[model samples]
Target: MRNSDPTLPPGAPPAAGAYTVPRTDPATPDGVGAVPGPSAAPDRVHAVASPPLVTHRECPAPHVLPGCAQSDGLSPASRYGELFVDVQHSGLFADSKTFPDCIPNCDPELIVTRYREQRATPGFSLADFVQAHFTRASVPESHYVSDPASTLHAHIESLWPVLTRKPMAHPPRSSLLPLPHRYVVPGGRFGELYYWDSYFTMLGLAGSGCGDLLLEMVQNFAYLLDTYGLVPNGTRNYYLSRSQPPVFILMVDLLEREQVARAIDFLPQLRREYAFWMDGAQGLRPGHAHRRAICLADGVVLNRYWDDRCCPREEAFLEDMQTAMYSGRPHHAVFRDLRAAAESGWDFSSRWLDTPAAAQPANLGTIRTTAMLPVDLNALLWHLETRLAELCDQAGDADAGDYRAAAQRRKEAIMQTMWDDAAGAFVDYDWCRGEPRRCLTAATVMPLFLGLAQPAQAQAVAQAIAARLLDQGGLATTELTSGQQWDHPNGWAPMQWLAVRGLARYGHDTLAREIAQRWLATVASLYTHECKLVEKYRIEPCGEHAKGGGGGEYPLQDGFGWTNAVASALMALYGDVAATCRVDVGDADSGGQPGHPLS
Candidate 1:
């Protein structure tokens, strides 16, 4: 049925490349242990354009991946040194990722030597030197035809080639890590495969019947694991300091289900990613934390978002540096917290900040992401633990029991610590304060989505979602309107999928269907207007009132991967709402805007 007339037609035009649009994780099983390239099929790529002559970051991923393992071990600071500092501080580019992503005019070694020689000269200008040395990073321009009247489905299907970066044998000496096959980017400024974003993107890819491209993405992730030990935030050296979230296991699950294959082939890389997160867990003491793992006072071990470096993020250098300057806390501590927030994916939210009230705004400087153990993160890890047990059982591995026991232990820890009976919802545990943060957010739905919540817990969380989090269009990310993209009014595609799927899993079908329909209506209203997809939506309003999302490190990104994918996947699950949406969003009772649209 899917193949007969697939959304992405097989006979679609062989890509001469499409036109540009408007610009805008692995983890291990549950364990309390302390911390710590693709081996893929021979699907090779032809060398495309010759490697651009340029100065590159020190950790240049080799043409062949295995040789690049050492690159992951070194910090960008050590590799790029003062040269990295100058480019970021001198403000040569608006986006911090720009300079690092650019190809150089000559060899990196020569550039660095010349930088030292000329930096102190009377007429030396950091900006001029950078301009002379680095070529501007490649920006995708429009080549694909855009039919304004085309249905959103048609538009998304047409995007596959536009978003796909061609396969390459040799990569330019830029910050980008090389991949063995052609892969799709999320669109706009993001030009590489991401860690967790792939799962939801894969869902859309699956629904669209873009099977070959989807599998290529999974293999690319495996390649990252083999080459870099873990998938960095994105396929770039600068992002090596942190990862988005530990959803690599979920991605693997997608593969196994689609391919009807065993998980053993990827077991090594799976375990390796798990070990990376648990690297410092072995020796961690109660009431202590190490790397991404935390040991509560009661000896329950859980995870938190973290970054290895206690410095500014290369992609967010200016903003991170400004946040540190304003933060009353130590600069190092601020940088770490900022990076940790980035890892949480809700980069700036009341969930991570020291806010006065759930709905009140907070300054970015008040972020304390590393100090809290998120309920969604713990639930995700629990999913990993249980899945690992199942996979081990499938392969007849003896350690399945260890993983099963670990999952049970984590479930108990989550119920005892993360569940707040008074709040009637699961909340993040602020280990530092020894209490639940009690910030109501879409994250409460994760437990249900992953089947970690008991029936009673699911009921309570569902009630909370309906009473607080659900807005006019879909689920608001958090209760607060903190001038952050992830907060009130804006809803992200991934969060909507999590809520809709989780609610349905818990038998809250009415709420789930309403959410799905309303969200589709909102997206339809926009696509009808802008003819483009975006990273997030202003879902606190009705379909007609919905607007483009804002308030983040960058502008609203178009040609969005997850948004397009979630749209396709959701339509596949729930019948396509194109006709219904064109008529009306839903009945009035679905969701009428309240005074504040809080939560």
Candidate 2:
């Protein structure tokens, strides 16, 4: 079998202890490699070297080698995190539920010694050493069926215990700070409290009357903001460099609606999170960029997704390394690709790439995520700012003025920078290229969702979406069929929800109901066959047999958090297909209307 990096010399062996992928069917997923040779087994291989000695430069931040003056003692969980990165070099855990828990339970030095001894013994295997010295937690079983009538509700109820985890055991602290309470994970391979996913999961939780769990999840996010300065994408140390979407404000807003008294309590965290996204805003001058916010040519600051670190992500270390090798770009640029993708929360989507659809072989290096100010992210921030202003008003605090002014500036900036008047839709601004990206994406509806768009603009956006973006399944993420999961033929629950609500806000009732019904039917039809809700759906309505949504770095995942939440919310709001179709979707309530004064 050939080595993983095609760029290497024809017969050159892989780097010491690097993952050596055996040849496999080209059609398979990127992370799934061919089985390794016996002597090059995963258990025997370290992440980057034969013995994998920890160097001051290579260790995860805050835990450089002991000799380094700034280094701190590596916690047991972090040690396990590093080990998990090493022992599972062949992407063993990339698609597994228990992979997240593959943290270190034994001494790192002893494990390294055992690895060396095993490699020295001609017939010995490193897998045997892992069996003797390490332990992995089992995935909790499910008690649901494929019957559509009851399956969705059944899985939501039954998976509570399966999805919920107690605080980390003491001996091995979680790579992250321990959670204050039990929380529901999104299940499948995602075994942590993902930032954006949790908000949607709470929808199902709230629908099922799991209010305590909902509150606990919000508290957990609050805890994250207090400790990490920003919520890491998920509750893992490795995800610390970036966050998913800034959905914490929405989560807290939901809590406020449910239990009005809690609103004031969460205000401080909301402000802190806003500060995290706008970290470098105060210093921004014309035509410069800061962490997440960029000053446009017009001197209006807008936001884009970015990560602080420019290195291979720990969880997808091997995949990122291989992508870098094939990218024909510098290592840091590829790292930016991976990080920027994470920031967008649509990892590996062509929406972030600079190349055209005709560009062959997926040059991920063309990804310029830091240089594109996405419409959805800015709209979400506008929502956050609006909400903060409301909270300040309710509490009689003067900061409401500041938040309102911030929101107004962002709203005007979005209108000026994102709206494509000729196309009658919003588009992402390629700051690096100084032009609108020209691709229409579901992200355009975000302004409508957050009540940021003016009435005429909202109507134009709705027309553009219905004319070119809507599909049989509901809504394609983008108008292009780029083989990336976030593009054509695929529709995700969150976008469906936002687009549906956004349309309704503008009194596009018939269109809004049509979208909601189509999405619900897709979910129902799939449930009848698969009996499970997946992370994404094939909504293109081609004559092909329905299969799992394909593309992206991983397989279609079930135990989907946002899917359940959005479906549950839609089901509650618009019940059966007949009723949903008949319902008149008018303007959203006065509070939900767009173009209202900030908050």
Candidate 3:
């Protein structure tokens, strides 16, 4: 994997351990009391403060949110519009997400009317106005602590209730789109149920004997499909304009394996989701794009991340606005790209940057998510197509053939456009640039994991995994550290699981086990002291110094649903949680060579 040169703005924390975790005790140092392995040390609490917020573009002084001025020609069409863009711009809450997530005490129109009434008055206070008109959002919190001696598996079991959200009887008007059944959130600042996150979280839920929640979560998504044209990025009104990576099919597959779900029952929902993604495919002309569907020059249809709305993300309004200001591009264009990246579930990664391998952290403004047809996303759609075929055939429907033909065309297109023989793996194709995005990410193994790759292709992908993507702790998200959560040194639960399952599918058991072992070790090492699971981990610098991964809008979060679930699932599949094989991970960096995953 190529190293990244981060070009972060002033006051932005570089990815140089910007997130600090306390070093554990010397006596029990290498502390893995919960699940012991080599260099299994616990980190003291993460103490590195988040970088100070900086609105990159200098707003005109005293203009009441200088970025909100109409002089820039950015007429954001948000219902909030210029009316209450002021609340976010005022920066009342430390986290920019706070204001958008707040439930209004009365109608939003009344709040706007009140704001207008009070705004021009001398000594008018935006903070006071907000306090009177809205209720602050409540971030989910857990005070439950695990016993120090409990195994990682047991701790995970105890955490299920903590992460689970019960159905609300009477919910307030907020960003959340309430579902009938209870579902799991990814935890921390992410308190809402995410579209793609539930699939990986289900792995742990199933292993910990919480399959009931898994079933309910799947049902909830189906319900969402029935209500909305497609499952939005998450269960939030703010997310209604976008959808995350379509993992709903995989979620149903997991339920089927448990012998509880029948794919035929979900045929309608499945078809609807596929239709949602392929909305503009049939009508698109060669070399044109619409929404999420991109048409190649060969007239082949593929998918790219996109959003229906072209405005700043409600949850990330301030940050998005700042990025647009810094981009030197039209605000609407940059806003669309930012939302599209969020829809990809890799909100910020070098993979979408103009110069992905730039020496310094590349400017956030360069992200062009809609320009690239991602290999993993297309592979997922292929699985969805094939699944639709199977279910349709099971129901004796004639459309099965249509789905099957679609699957074949998609697979062939993927191989022709995305497979880079020189890179020994599949890569994303930038349709706008007419080039390949060669950033080596753990996503390269998606085709193999889904059983969509030929033997030679799988072999080449496995070699690529061993040679570049692997690290001492586990597979890094990508080789570049661009101060993005989805970039280098950070290993996410979904990525690690995909690599492990994919490698093992191709009969590379040794490499699979090694990757799984290192990830489990890294997770369990922190579990000993923190007694908690985090959203992501620092896998590259794998030693006592290892801790939760950082770099993004939010701080490292605990009660992390996917991490807990993936950790438990890995323990069940690879080994007992109480016993992990010791791998010397601290000094095990390997240059691009076909070697051990944890070497």
Candidate 4:
């Protein structure tokens, strides 16, 4: 099982500081290894066999003088090389994307020392050092800056040009973390392609006649799947240990309109992605579990969000350290919560809290996300399975039979395990307690969105949403006021889209349209005041919370990608002559027609 040679194959260790993905053979049966069997520990860990050892002592940049005094303990790459991470945690650099890349051919310590020395000298400013040593990623001012004149449609149209990243160079350099094909980034703090965010962004691109970009993004995802076994959370080395929600199947479905014939071409990658999620699934037996999979008392298998590395996130390093310090729990347990939160994409929600007493509610150490079968995660996998079966049927692949059978079993397990008969909703299942979490969040609508709910079930879910979750502005993430971005009063773009679409699917168009209109109006109101779209909004009646929908690590960000895209889509669907009249201008020069019906 062990090999000294670095290049033997993936799953075997590579050179000390290199990364290798465990590739699965497409033609082989049991291509991806199964989850451990009944005797294995239920809380077993599954991680990269040998992750690259990134340390300050072994700096990759060659400019550091060997045996120099500064080289004794300093890692420039750790401190200054990743400007994105530094600025995010710094609180000094307010704008995430406006910072310069690392200064080439210079030691980080020497640069910092010299910059300080220059500042002490007469008339010497930080800008002088920046001019001498660094280059800006782009001219932020030349690009569209937020302004009062900008409408949501205008901002979105402007973003298509600014956020679209071109393909990377061939035989990508070792230092490069870029993807091989063009893709759009969520704006402001996020300057790279994200896994789940891309799908929502594509919806706007497709509706706006930018289907070409949609195809290119899908091509990028395929490239990642082929190269890395699974797409990293983002196109970054730090994100390799875990992935966000699997939305590649949905991305492929969105692009099928233009390339329907090539739809089956993505099946191989789709199968591999499924294998990654279900890596431990096949070995499940009664009363046993493994990474990402577990067995219920009745022997049904289900999924949960998991991360291989149980540690603090690199981007929010200091915040995580402080949280762990105050958590009064073992460091290992805190790490699991942090990683599980990342996998959920609701990094710090009350949905993950383990106990009612728990010493304190905000104590992140109480997070038990790994011990719960998330409703949204399972529903997403169900969609993927259903899609795989359809594509297999089209291509006449023999795997069609297996996929259809898997989809059916998953649908049955979801209904039996997640359904809350009295609550009239689908709730996240706590594997430890063997009962529903009963949060009544926006995730309940996921089954409806996927068309997996019976008519009665869908009706109940809709009623639950209206009764507990929905507000005047739109749907809240959950009923709690935990000061987390994913909790109450902080309605997000993706959740709103899910709730609206899910309601519409179950013959509740009137309610769906009402929610959509209200959300769109909220967006308009926020834009009118701030002159920019944001990541999340205070969807409560404005006076409920102290600062309104604010929480999480940072302040509300603008140049928002998903918000603009989702708003554009909803406005197109619901905007009438009266709504169109509300727009400041008839149309803008950038091919932006704010009130025009989507083609």
Best model number under TM-score: 3
What's the residue-level lDDT of 494 in candidate 1?
A: 94
lDDT at 16, model 2: 48
lDDT of 1 by residue, 129-151 (tens): 87898787665543245699888
The Cα RMSD in angstroms, rounded to one decimal, for candidate 3 relative to the true structure is 13.8
lDDT against the true structure, each candidate? 0.70, 0.66, 0.71, 0.64
Using all chains and alpha carbons, the TM-scores for the candidates as numbered come to 0.84, 0.81, 0.84, 0.76
- Residues 446-545, model 2: lDDT tens digits: 8887788888888888888887888777777888776667777888988888887787877776677777887877776677667777788888765533
What ordering of candidates by TM-score runs from best to worst? 3, 1, 2, 4
Name the regions of candidate 2 deviating beyond 4 angstroms: 1-100, 109-124, 137-161, 168-177, 357-362, 542-546, 578-599
Off by over 4 Å in 1: 1-63, 66-77, 122-125, 141-145, 357-360, 542-545, 578-599
Question: 349-425 in candidate 4: lDDT tens per residue?
Answer: 88887534533344455677777898889989988888898998999888888888888888899988899989999
**How good is model 2 by TM-score?**
0.81
**Native-vs-model 3 lDDT?**
0.71
Model 3: colliding residue pairs:
5-359, 5-360, 5-361, 6-360, 6-361, 7-360, 7-361, 22-44, 31-41, 588-599
- The per-prediction tally of clashing pairs is 25, 3, 10, 1
Model 1 quality (TM-score): 0.84
